[model samples]
Target: MFFLSLVVLDPLVVVLVGLVRREGIGLAGAVMALDLCGNWWGNWHWLRDDPSQLLRLLPLTLFGVFVVASTLPLHRVVARTTARSETALPSA
Candidate 1:
């Protein structure tokens, strides 16, 4: 629950951690997609039983919001921080 909200507040953490620990931001998003699907499966009782539109859309909406937030701002940061030397493949 808290983790879901934090993504809204700041998705940069997810992007950075994904880039640093995994291969890139895409993997991080894939992980989040898995989590989203898991949430739908795990919480189907409440989600299906809920009457409010907000409640129904909450979890599903979060993934798209987080993905956009994580990618848009970080695109600038990555462009600024990375150089050709850093992104280039090393000659072996």
Candidate 2:
């Protein structure tokens, strides 16, 4: 239950934060997709106990690593883009 919550909640939180911050929809969608894929991969093992536990774990672990590696750069890009658009708007 805890893991399931993490899987669902984390992406939702990220998406909401992105939207509230006025980040691009395309980028937010991509991030959500990646997050869901990673969450699925991370939780795949719990679906069944197979002979390929390691195989299932491999992708999950890799996904985690990828998330850790990419999150900062992704956040930076979103922030910069949002800032640019906001600054481009004419002052009221």
Candidate number of the best lDDT: 2
lDDT by residue (1-92, candidate 1, tens digit) is 74566565346645666565323454456556666666667777775677464576586668666974586465656665666546685877
Best by TM-score: 2
Runs in model 1 with CA error above 4 Å?
1-22, 53-60, 63-65, 68-83, 86-92
Q: Alpha carbon lDDT of residue 91, candidate 2?
A: 100
lDDT of 2: 0.62
Model 1 deviation from the true structure expressed as Cα RMSD, one decimal place: 7.1
Q: Give the TM-score (vs. native) of candidate 2.
A: 0.53
In order, what is each prediction's RMSD in angstroms?
7.1, 6.7
Tens-place lDDT per residue, model 2, 18-64, is 57543433444455456656566666677466646666556655766
lDDT against the true structure, per candidate, is: 0.60, 0.62
